[model samples]
Target: MEAAPAVLTFSPSSSSPAGPRPCRVLAGPAPRRARALAAPHPPRAVASSRAPLVVSSPPPPPAASGTPATTPAHAKVDRSGRFCSPRAARELALMISYAACLEGADVVRLFDRRISARREPGYVFDKACLLSYNHMSFGGGPLEVGTEEEAEKLTSQNEMDSANEAEVLSAPPKLVYNSFVLRLTRELLVAVASGWNKHVDILDKIIPQTWKDEPVARILELCILHIAMAEMTSKGTPHKVVINEAVDLAKRFCDGGAPRVINGCLRTFVKDHVDNTGTSQAAESKA
Candidate 1:
């Protein structure tokens, strides 16, 4: 993965609001923060792919009525490569602690060995996770969930390609890049340094920082913000979403609470903010 350019330093234009804010560019795996808060505005020129915030969010969920998330027994395996009864509990106990740094080299070896080891019940899932981390060595960000949405898009896209094959394929070169989103991704990695045991590695250098930059400190802030967002969300998706679905998700995940809070908050953000996210190819050709 190419290194993102150093953050552009500038005093806010008079039009911009004033306050403390996390780096708007961080966009890697969602960091777990000690708390969460509204971040200051992003640079309107950055063209971030995250849709601009629009609507007001719904009220956050009330305190829970004391229920626990249950993990199944088969999910846990001992270091000896043997399964234990009461699996869920044991797995939680043995699992890597929060922010545990299972290094890049060690991660590669562990995955290679685990994949070749055997076919356990959840072995495939475990293998996928390890392979994913390896890819992070090259590219680390949210792994897209290949759901029905993607499948339908893929099929339609494929059909269009087949029909258009007759057209001349040659075209002038154009850089396919989103500087903002890429920057967001790198900043997130720095904001949450999970590749080692609280140690900075090659990733830090790739993402250049200003003269006054602290790796561990920034990561902590990112983690706090994300965690607080989840908690305030009643453990639902914190991202802004379409209206009805946002409400429904909150209700389902928040143990049957009012759904409007999530919806309102998301709607307000999208409505109020301006954005410069990259357009899909469809939009570009039309332009």
Candidate 2:
């Protein structure tokens, strides 16, 4: 026997099985790398064609209870470097005179009282009346205009002027008027008082019989006449302008044919008194 081939033998360690033991898979969580590789991806969002909705904030609530809303006073319009216009003074004088006539009191004293009268506590004068006062709203014939655009422009301008005049007239005498306006108003009041006394007899002759019978109803018209005559007598404003202003006042304050009647009366006054006075003065100067 040839020396027998040496047989190779393998030995196993104490902790592990010998030779090709089946792959020992321990029952435990998978490795982090293996789990990450097996995870699924989320889907992407789709694009839209619809418009986005917009949300707006709500309006503020009204004022608290017991608190009244107040209107702001309008600012005075300064014209020709004057705070108040002569027209405004004339309007104020007319109002004061009308009030005096109603109360059967002295116009100057009434004016002083009005100027000095105190405002009530927490009293807010409603200037809305002043702003909304439209002379045309009182009633008048339609305006003659060439076109709608022209009519609109004219109407807008007239409204602006009327509102401005109303603001000036409505303001307190001590606050709104400058020295010139105050002096002018005082002089007008004095002239009205004196001229009224002097022209009391003349008014009867000029006014219609119907008006004469109802003097109470015609107080405004009479006041207009007195103011116009007083203003004319001062020789400050032109007689034509005075007459026009008087007619306008009648149109604004009086109804029906008052404007026409006022115009006729003013013309008559100019013709009878102003022209004669001028003629007599000129003759005296020449002599």
Clashes in each model (backbone N, CA, C under 3 Å)? 37, 0
In candidate 1, what are the lDDT values of residues 89-112, reduced to their tens digit?
A: 111111111122111222222222
Candidate 1 lDDT? 0.25
Q: Give one digit per residue, the lDDT tens place, for model 2 in 1-287.
A: 76542221111111234422121000112221112111221111111212322111111244689999642222233433234557657766777776565445666767778788886687444444443333232334444444555544554554454445445355566655566767777788877765554455567677778766555556677778888987877645777889888887776556678889889887877776665432322224446
Q: Tell me how far candidate 2 lies from the true structure as C-alpha RMSD in angstroms.
A: 46.0
Model 2 lDDT at residue 141: 40
- The alpha-carbon RMSD values of the candidates against the true structure, listed in the order shown, are 23.7, 46.0
Listed in order, each prediction's TM-score against the native is: 0.19, 0.56
Error of 1 at 236 (Å): 20
lDDT of 2: 0.54
Residue 231 of model 1, lDDT score: 27
Among all windows of 10 consecutive residues in model 2, the one with the lowest summed lDDT is 24-33
